[model samples]
Target: MELTYLQTFREIVKWGSYTRAAEQLGYAQSSVTTQIQRLEASYGAVLFERYGRTMRLTMAGEALLPYASEMLRLHAESKEVVSKQSAGALTIGTIETLAAFFLPPYLQAYRRDYPEMKVNLQPGNEPFIIEAVKEGTMDVGLILDPPLADPELHTVVVRKEELVIAAHPDHRLGGLAAAQVRDLAGESLILTEEGCTYRAMLLRALKEEGVEHQLSYEFGNLEAIKQCVVYGLGVALLPRIVVEEELRNGRLKAVPFSHPSCEFYTQLIYSRKKWMSAAFRDFIALMRGGRGEASKMHE
Candidate 1:
């Protein structure tokens, strides 16, 4: 009956664990359990069932999911309609690379425009961000990926982000006019963890070209991957924006490489069903204006 209980249920589904959801919501595990129990009582249906070590949504839970999302969305809409507030919270789901290197200046300018607005930059992989946008959870999502069209969401290509293969200054492949897939054969590669969009692109391209390379290291953190490349552990595929400073400082070299499959973009996505806020439109406008130039940045 309580909206907060529904919120908890959604959080549980998002996190896939009672304890994890509780931590995310800043509630005790017992409190989360009690809230879920109350939610179940109101519906008179078991929401979750244990499948081995994981808790999975039961048939009833699957049925309630959409209604719960719609109710929460409407609740948010009601507040927006009634208050007509000049400033409020805006959550943007994005990936770590964009959060670290790409979004700060745009966000800073946005803050200057809406100083009272609370901007929550939620970081996740591309797929998770897309799903969160569709679910009405994130106000908008910025993802580095190939251009994709979804009926449930409005997609905008903010910029075509160039992916590059980074190597140390002393590496054998350095100073070449350009590197091709053929050049990658037998080379040791330091890769991002499995889900990275560019990483997948690179692996797929290599597989198609029959290029065999060593997977020397797999790091989730971009900085770690850069550091390893700097030490000559191996070359890595990453966005050009991320390694700009290193390349300028003579630490890393961008192997001249560009392939059709590896081309990704900084894309903006928002649900077609959700009402767009003024702040949301302004943020997208700023992104389209230009990426804050690196030389102008103080950070």
Candidate 2:
């Protein structure tokens, strides 16, 4: 099948209509229909089944989806390899805290060094970032304590961040040098929403210690959780980087946890099969402190 035919097929499947796909691809509706017919003729299988006006993918179409995506990706990579332009786009997925506290300087440096390269930063929780990287939608991901058994992705520890239990300055744990994991039992806790890696780690630690606590509030934003903790609403486990200002101002106190797992890591992750462009490589080097000659750009 021709690349254009496969492109039309993919677009049609995505939009679920020849008219819409044709509109998107700047082709006539009849041309879109003809391209799908050619693709179906080549495969000798019905790719889509029509139910009134709505078209859905058949089994054959579902099976062809991944292969079509791979072929398109390979085609783009091959073009990039042969192209003289060294600068391209890089999309990075990260968590909110890292986007706010950790990535600003690094990203600013990258932009200065490669002015022609476009950088897209998408912030979300760990699971969303991980999935984006795995699916090839994101060029890289900065995640926390990634899974060891994910064979499709490669990860390196870029930074070790301290995790601290923070409470209002007047809270009982504020005066202690270190609090036991069991001390959290029955205490009101403000935590990130479910599926957050740090929150999951905290829950796992609590479960391991057989300490059950009240999850008093769940929030998606780190700042909201910090505000809640600062006002004595509840205690929260957070990265030290996110609460440095509060801790310094004495608005919140870091209740050091006795558990050894209180320390966590920020890991740089990407797919193992990804083609590392020069810009992408430099971005990784920047994150790892191997800036080399690129450091001059910051000056």
Candidate 3:
């Protein structure tokens, strides 16, 4: 099958509409239809199922998705290699909180030292970031305590971040130096979305301690969570780095919590088999507070 056909198929799957995919690919509607027909005719399997106005992927389409993605990735890499376009270009994936609080200084320092390098930062949940690294779509991933043990990936611990229960200054638990999980039983808890690593840890701690509480609000954005807490909506468990400014400004109070899971590590991770370019190596070294030999080249 042609690469353009595979690309068209992937775009159709992403948009869930043939017309939308055609619009995005700058192809006439008939061309998209003909391409899909040719692709299905060659494979002898139906790729997509049409139900009136809606379209959904068939079993064949589901099976083809991963291979299509891999082929596209390899094609891009080959072009980069042939054109020598990969150097000085780094793509990193990370979680939202780290993108906000932890990465700024290190990124600034790296840019100052290697002004010729180009950095692209993409933020998502832990699994999304890890998958991007594994697929070679991202050069590296910075995540918070990824739970899975993948033999293909190597992880380096960057730092352990302390988690604390944060609330408005007027909250009753605000004055405590440290509080037990059970202490939050009667309180309303503001939480991040389900995929958040720290949120998962916090829930596990409460469950193990037999503390039942109400989830007052669930937010996907860290700033929104902080704002809700500041307005006395609820107490939330958050990384200290995320709340440092609010804590210092007296807008929020971080009460240290008594739990083993209160501390989670930030890790820099990448595929073990992936080639380490000088730029990638230098970035990893910067994150680890080590100046690798690559640093001397740019100097």
**Model 3, range 191-219, lDDT digits (tens) per residue?**
99988988998889888888889988999
Between the candidate structures 2 and 3, which one is better when assessed by lDDT?
3
Q: What local lDDT does model 3 show for residue 204?
A: 92
Better model by lDDT: candidate 1 vs candidate 3: 1
Best-performing candidate as measured by TM-score: 1
Q: What is the lDDT of residue 48 in candidate 3?
A: 97
Comparing 1 and 2 on TM-score, the stronger one: 1
What lDDT score goes with residue 156 in model 3?
75
Off by over 4 Å in 2: 1-58, 146-149, 291-299
Report the poorest 10 consecutive residues by lDDT, candidate 2: 290-299
Each model's lDDT comes to 0.86, 0.82, 0.83
Each candidate: RMSD to true structure? 4.4, 5.2, 4.5
Ranking the candidates on lDDT from highest down gives 1, 3, 2
The parts of candidate 1 lying over 4 Å away from their true place are 52-54, 290-299
TM-score of model 1 vs. true structure: 0.91
C-alpha TM-scores of all predictions: 0.91, 0.79, 0.82
Which 10 residues in a row give candidate 1 its minimum summed lDDT? 290-299
Q: TM-score of predicted model 2?
A: 0.79
